[model samples]
Target chain A: MGIKRDISHTVWSVRGNAVMDVVTRSLEPLIAALRAAGYTVVGPTVKDRAIRLTEISSAAELPDGTGDVQEPGNYRLTERDDGMVFGYAASPDSAKRFTQPPRQTLIRSRGQVIEEVEPEAPRIALLGLRACDLAAIAVQDRVFLGGRHPDPAYRRRREALFLIAVNCAVPGGTCFCVSMGTGPKATAGFDLALTELAAPHRFLIETGSERGARIVAAIPHQAATGDDVAAADEVSRTAAGRMGRTVDTEGVQEWLPAAHDHPRWDDVASRCLACTNCTMACPTCFCSTVEDVTDLSGDVAERSERWDSCFTLDFSEVGGSPVRGSQRGRYRQWLTHKFATWYDQFGTSGCVGCGRCITWCPTGIDVTEELSAIRYGTEGPSCIR
Target chain B: MDARQTGRRPRLAVWKFASCDGCQLTLLDCEDELLSIAAEMEIAYFLEASSAPGPGPYDLSLVEGSITTPEDAERIRHVRRVSRRLVTIGACATAGGIQALRDFADVREFTSVVYARPEYIATLERSTPISANVPVDFELRGCPIDKRQLLEVITAFLADRRPVVPGHSVCVECKARGNVCVLVAHGTPCLGPVTQAGCGALCPAYNRGCYGCFGPAETTNSGALNAKLRALGMSDPDLVRVYRTFNATEEPFRRASEEAEGDA
Candidate 1:
């Protein structure tokens, strides 16, 4: 017996020589197939001077040979010699935007006629999703769908989606998914995981779901060999090794609460703009509040929920008094919750270590640096294994 | 006036001014207390809570943020009209917030540094507290007001009584918590002596000096703190930065900061 079959799906790998041709050739066919199946094909494309997820009809629309340089409040485009279409790291916009839009209408009412609006189920095939984003989706699933009060709208949108995950070959300046134990390779929660090996123009496809297996079987592909598996493993390792940042999460939950009053918060808060760009770019930040508006005529009324951040002074308002009255307190609350309290609440770190917050912030406030300050300030016993 | 016998719950309204919508979020953080509060009070105008906002002659109004623009100034007055007992929450509403850093410098310089088109920005030269513009019934201090205190205030309002909020210094809380004083022990420049009590003296417990997010305590001796800060080798600029925190505009702190900078 060579290898036991795990399921109905076949594990296939393409020769390095045939990788690019297979990818280019399959791109249009996959889009056409998805479109014909009444699904919108959404993938990475150059938009607003950066590679962002957009609707794609063909491979020509893909962000070919473009990589993104991300820093706090600064992002620029860089060209790559390799014609890899999905060569870049994650963009400022996460898949959460599509799943949980910035503002969503909850209910509408007009006099006695109160109508509850259910969001229309949109069938979307997300192409070239990075591993960090996949983990972010999992974090969101825990927040919106797995919570005690499941959001009916988010559940509907999530149920009607197909995920195509891509193994990141080049990590961005801000990426630290390896430290978060969430990325560099697509391990699960995907319909299909594609590793692009362009020499022979083929994508090494691994099916994660039943639907993915069906899609793989429909496509023209070859069975995996020992050499192909080794190459795939090597590429994943390289991607993991490329991460520029690492967060020491060892006993962070236990340490942060103990070091709550550390002077480090004062140092960090002084520089923080508190503009809330970090929370906006953060994929796991689920804090939101509802807003109601009546038309000028007062006949038609609508309620909408929009994203809110803890950094804002009004976020903690109560009978004419704010609890966290200083930028220091607010900044401390956000960081501690993400690194420490989140583990107490969710059994995991709130941050996925995407580094988007670090890069997109106007002031370049790094969470890792702040955490380091706490680690050094205290005299507690070390927990790093 | 039994609430149930009256057949009309006290109307509650939430208002926002010129700040990020963070302090308002603290109310929503009271997830367990919220539904119960809703059961007791009729939420008339919480834009962040419900879409159907009833016209307000609210018994209680929770106001957040500061007056930073001309529009905010007018809007706050309108809020005061609708609210019978208007309470200003957070540092911004009470002490002009971190945005009040604009008060120390030329607004044009700050705007040029932050925005590409400074002309497009419609901001007052200085951020001012809601009390400066309207008759505030109460002022709650904090960068983000504590959720528990918020609940207490709401419960007190429902009962037609004054809210139980401590006005002592952070030093009192630090002593109550039995934490070693970071300032005395480590020679750290702590503001716990002059800052308002709240946050349960969190910074001192973490082995850091308090940065005075809760603003001024009643009869705060900032002059004494400034002398101590100078003794601890802090520069005049550093002292200015310290006084100009969450409640920099408050009288004692403002006067002390001016004296420290030799402007008095």
Candidate 2:
């Protein structure tokens, strides 16, 4: 699924699809329906004092009446006045956790016998996925499935996924989905798109697939009026205005590669720990490395594919020495790959402006600000020399 | 016939100097896999397991702890000569352990205060790592080297390959495990950004900040992380104290701690 030109609810209404209005209480039934169809329903839930994507058996497990306060290197859960499901911004994790796992054994061998390990693709209905993450899933799809040699494990998991995208109402302090043109409203790539409205406490659902319609049909939902559509549009419009950050993407694809020697990289490198946090938290970054391990007897061996980051010195290792030895080169490679080189490789920018990288960074390094520094040549206050 | 086909197991020796013996205990803690490891190789000289000492010309020597005494310095050199490959295990052997904190201050004063007879104690002024005394083939990092990683090192030795220990930060392991950033989420002072990837990011996973047990990563910007920690209300003393734990004598942590002390 791709980002649609028009995000207005009227466009979806005009497409002859039923705009169904379901109450906050109907979420339990929606979850039940997904589970009844042989799916392990997963959604955002409060865990470790943060909203983490995990398997949720009931809708009550969702972080209702809860929001989040986020800044560079900071994130705190706050209690909201109204009990609204999907009240917070993007979770610390994204759809990638389900689509592309952190670790998967690809091959296993026992002495003379060798076997390729097939991935266990359980039908997972991902609920409360924001548009930024939906877009990230699309980027991953291009990375894993679009190319000539498609990753079989990624393919199996991707095919089994049932996406349920949520239109973000409460934008996090680090969110810049508006600037990226990827969020505030779930435009596409969802089986069912939901916009949670307050005061009346209802969800305006727009079914994107036949499977979504089938599930919604089973649940008790009313045919939404024009008022509901307008209300849903207003929620998205307000969220768009309240975006915590913005990136000027104009001509970024052309100039970022040429700015390799720019002093901003050295500036970022001084602050960048090369901790691999930004890449790990990033929704769209799909780099991985293979690991081979054998038992003590050397009889049983396994080759597994695990998530890797460009920040690691070993990631750029060639002939026993890393080409990007300095933190400056590593950080530059990551930033350039995300914003500029990604377009060349995958035909789209890597960043969805979800702000996970900003929030999760130990030093609070803002990617948007970094790009602005590169583009405008305005060096921000240096924290360290 | 090859060594494996001829049923000639390689001799493996375990050694200790000045440490808590926790790293040695990690080898013993491998309850299930210890038997398999024993079956694969000859457990020639592990005092922790058996009293019977084996002959020299050992295949591999897994040394634990630091060289606090002059005798240990001489012993490590002898160990290097006898063993085909000498792999130093844990923070003590690799980075001088927490005992290396004496490197910053006077050891004589401490001996006088603690010991009844300071004259009886014959110790070096500075507790140095095994690498400082002799040529080490590999240094397995951690406050107490992880059993899994220790096994991996042994496996690599048997396979005639280099051990696949990643030199990335604890943040990589923490993020891979899908744990929330304790430092970022709660403003907890963590060494995860600079600490080496090992122990599966134990502290952060349990909602506590990293203590740099595995020492600094291959490439670390502690100055940057220190700035962030300072912003989170960490004082100069706190920075010094935090960096001066477990693998305190490691270059990056040692330098950072010294800088913090200087700033203080």
Candidate 3:
């Protein structure tokens, strides 16, 4: 519904606004463009030793001159000498936090009369969001927007968003966007896409929407040469080369379920804390539960929807007992649904290969590693044990 | 009259045996929902709230803390007889509590270690759950039960339906809250995998590992967790000490602690 259908990655010239041609807008002006349009811009900010999406009014808030190092269960943000802006991988906070918050008040009731609670849909310009996260948001859209019962709340916040995608320049130690076919370069599903021309202190911006073009027109940007586009491609190519891990995308949907009986489940389960870190960190995991709270005077009662996890026993309680009574069973359900059954439900794979689960797991249980083990492990390992 | 026009509410009582009163405080902490609870049910015997005690035949009774003395043992039996529906709340009632550390060491030795007059004190050899002596209809996990969950438990009974407390690991809650794992990333030894879901994955969100306040989840893989802990440099003594914390005597942790110390 924004910037009327312009082709993906189409390079456009920023024309003069009401005044003269104000050629060449910098990173800070680009952020100002979003803020001027009554959009609250949010992007990766260095906070608490990690890059997280926080409210930003200018380019100074972005993790400039700082990059993060991530490995199996380890994440640390470090200072960079070259002062390169947008020189980092995905942060723990994503579009899901802003789109579907941890807690949402669903309904407030007083006996028979009940008032519905609508999600707060603020006009937000999301800057520096990565390619995998764009795909992850699409997956969320499928769950909340492309469903039979469209969640009004998710739909509201989602519609109010002005998505700005960033092509990956430096893949983290755990990133594998190449294998998932989700990133390293921006493909689709964004209003504006930016590629940081390596070490040049400049971003080659491409408009994917009319709103993006209008913003560019209102502000100022120099006409790009063919070398700028070529440089953008080269930058993305380098990022693709730097991927540390790879997801076996060769019919993962089929093999994951077919190998459901494989013993690797037990192998992973032993080291697996069943803490559900993977699901929580996942941009697409959308399970939630309803809580009914009555005020102290018993006059007003409220029903709130909170994020729920399949790993919890309370999630599958039936006839006074949880159906997934074991950690092994719960983990199997989570993985199988994410990798296998998700295709049947959403017409796509659930994982975008962002590597959050691996980086965040207390025991550092890697899903890709587990998948490989399941596909190639020896015979007869029971999850029940 | 549906108690709409009438002020009389359903009789409810809160009982404590041998705990820190953290669980009872959790109820008083429900400042917003307290009025709703008061409107629906009569506060028949919450010493934490009111001083006066009401007579028995209460509709519901919430018993906290573990049974520690002979008086506690007999008193709970009487409470069971009087209350129609009795639910045990928090670690102490559900599992034995931090005091259950006495389960590992000698109680007589403990008495001599602290008490001025060992002969004057009266105590049980083991700090046991309320269910050990009397029948408890439902058990809620957590050192101090989560308030919203407590509200759900009370309201569910009022509506005559089963409670919606899940028994999955703290991992799920961790994901729900979007907390990055402290254990995997920082090599912080955590019990989130085997610990039951609740507390909204609080510790992990704060960049710290879970201390297992809610006891073990439904099916705990202590063997695997132990192996990982060993790799992380936890000695035999560390393993024993880890399990012998808040819910020390809870079977899964107790058994794991016993196994860890059995060799050391």
Q: For model 2 chain A, give the 10-residue run with minimal summed lDDT.
A: A1-10
* Top model number, lDDT: 2
In model 2, what are the clashing residue pairs, if there are any? none
On DockQ, the candidate that comes out on top is 2
Better of 1 and 2 by lDDT: 2
lDDT of 3 by residue, B1-264 (tens): 333345557689999999999999999998987887887898899998899999988888999999989999999999999898899999999988888888878999999989999988899999999889898999998988999789888887776666768777887777566565566555678888889977888888888888999999876778777877887889999999888888898888989898899868
lDDT of each: 0.74, 0.86, 0.79
Each candidate's TM vs. the true structure?
0.59, 0.96, 0.88
Tens-digit lDDT track for model 2 on A1-385? 2223322111233225454544333688899999998889999899999998899999889998889999888999999878887889878989887888989998999999999898988899999999898888888888887769877787778767788888998888889988888987878778788888877888888887667777888888887778888898899999898888888888998889989899999999989999999999998988889899888999999999888999998898999999999989888889999999998998989999899999988888998888888888676532111
Identify the runs in model 2 with alpha carbons over 4 angstroms from their true place: A1-15, A18-25, A379-385, B1-6
Report the lDDT tens digits of candidate 1 across residue range A21-112: 12323566667766776779898887646676778898789888998776433456789888877788877667777677766788899876
Model 1 residue B180 distance off true place after TM-score fit, in angstroms = 47
Tens digits of per-residue lDDT, candidate 2, B1-264, equal 334656799889999889999999999999999999899889998998899999888888999999998888888888999998899999999989889989989999999999999999999999899989989899999988999899999999888777779999998889889899999887888898898987998998999999889999998899998999899899999999999987787888989998889999
Tens digit per residue, CA lDDT, model 3, A244-363:
788675877888888767777777767766656677788889988887766444556788887777866667879878898766777888888888899999988888888887777656
Residue A242 lDDT in candidate 2:
87
